[model samples]
Target: MSVRIGFIGVGGIAQSHLSGLLTLPEAEIVALCDISRQQVEKAVERFNKEAVGKEPAGRKLEAAIYDDYRQMLRREKLEAVFICLPPFVHGEVEEAVIEASLPFLVEKPVALSLSLAGKILDGVLKKELITTVGYQLRCGSFMDKARAALAGKTVAAIVANRFGRTPGVSWYHRQDKSGGQLVEQATHQVDMLRYLVGEVDTVYAAAATRINNKDNPEYDIFDSNCMTMTFACGAVGNFGNGTMAHVGVPPGLNGVHIFGDNVQVTIGGNLRIATPDGVTEEPLDKDMMVRQDSAFLKAVAENDPTLIRSDYLSGVRTLAVTLAGEKSARTGQPVKVADLLAAEAPAAL
Candidate 1:
């Protein structure tokens, strides 16, 4: 009854997903696909070596490596796939997955552009597939407590700041490929805002590239961006994203602050949820990928879309919000998420 899982894109994020899948008893990583043959071979070899003392009899870790994901999909009896490909390539792969009628878990920034995102959403709804997007912050206990404590009370405002070093990948620096800081990285915070509050209706933003120019000439993508958002429920949010943090800062050292009528939650190096009653500091567990993977597997087994928290449709909306912010930054005007999606129809793709 174990679900056969195939991993596409053996990049850093893919490795995190792979590590988590290895711990789940209801699932097994049956195949690996990547554009780089050497990386695929290395992944297979590493998994085999690591399996020596862990895999069950006749169930030793074995994965077929492939250079093309379509070939892997065609050849394997895969129950699900975890796509960790770059943002620009996400739409087509997701379209194919939808066509195949298989459950999939796609990494964040769902698509590079709004038009492509809409097309992916159309395909997903047409196929009626179960999907989960990689917005793991929603799975955190601290985030849950924040949501609960802030309930019933009107949110006055929300402020979130994320500062970290640039990713090592060259494509990550190019706005054309990754959609800049807001779409590529800060989409998580945007989605979290929607989850904790409500859907966003309008966005005004400003962005600039302040660093990593030497290594990236096409890095027109923002190294820093700040956005002001108005939610459908009339609440307002302010968010800042940047790659300005020194290399020495821990990955989670980035900051997020949520303010409500009675509660203010501040989470950064550690999880802290506070209200007028008292303050509680909980150490954030660094196992979001594992939690996300387990949740996706359970959804797949049960064939329940509701169980998949961040399904493809919701992922598309979040992507639209982030992309609208990007457009707002570029145009120096506030952008409506609905209008942005309409203007960039699928024909542009």
Candidate 2:
């Protein structure tokens, strides 16, 4: 049986999810929710244009647009929903999904603040609903190879550097809205580090807003930040992020380099795996997001939690690490992940 999917916050990322879902035969988008009527209409028109040449005569595209997600959820009998809204809006949507006993896939960072992230976690625990987060990089073939290459070996240190154009989203400039680049974009690298290595125990960070003045006046959020993390496994990690790279550089140049006892692995847009025996370069595959979508659909079809690549708990742990780094940056002191999580009680769902 096909799974009916509803999407909340029909924006650029929602469009990407729609594109990914179109590739899965067992998944069908039945409804879309966005605040702007124009955006909803535009999305419908675009989908119609794309479907005209492909779908069979009788298999018409079936989707209704909504301005309020609660109304969409109330009116549509959907098997699953994808929360593609901004970070600040995620907590409430997730709580509603859990209460409705519907499976959901939320985009990264989970929530804009630690308190909301905790709340989402509590709701998930209470509802015991199937959940996944958008950490698509974990589905990359190169990342898997990199993880295997580092397993069982003592990781001495990890270094990640990410540089790119300033985020085009309006919320990118507001810390309360988007959680800045550390939580918004750099969280991917941070999560990868923890996935490849182990749980992060503490973080020390420094940050500055040296550039992107035109786009980010007041500069409440940092344009660049550096963090050092201590993992429970005794390995240390250093990560740097900058939104001020020259315009000539590609949109995103992000990579993780792992130093281990036997092999050193670096994976990003390009892949390089090195060991004592030899060095090999793995070709970058462009199908990571496609594979991620396929995995999520497979999980939904089977109703098996293990099939989901990044579950809700894993996403929360990663969010905690990223948020810890943010706290460290702001306070000029080292922050512990456990303390951060403990300080904020989950929202009452």
Give per-model TM-scores.
Answer: 0.92, 0.93
lDDT (C-alpha, whole model) for all candidates: 0.80, 0.82
Cα lDDT tens digits, model 2, 308-342, are: 77888888888888888888988999998878777
How far out, in Å, is residue 234 in model 1? Answer: 2.0
Task: List per-candidate RMSD values in Å.
Answer: 3.0, 2.8
The candidate that achieves the highest lDDT relative to the unseen native structure: 2
**TM-score (C-alpha) between model 1 and the true structure:** 0.92
Clashes of 1: 0
lDDT tens string, model 1, 139-184? 8777777778878988878788787877788688777788788888
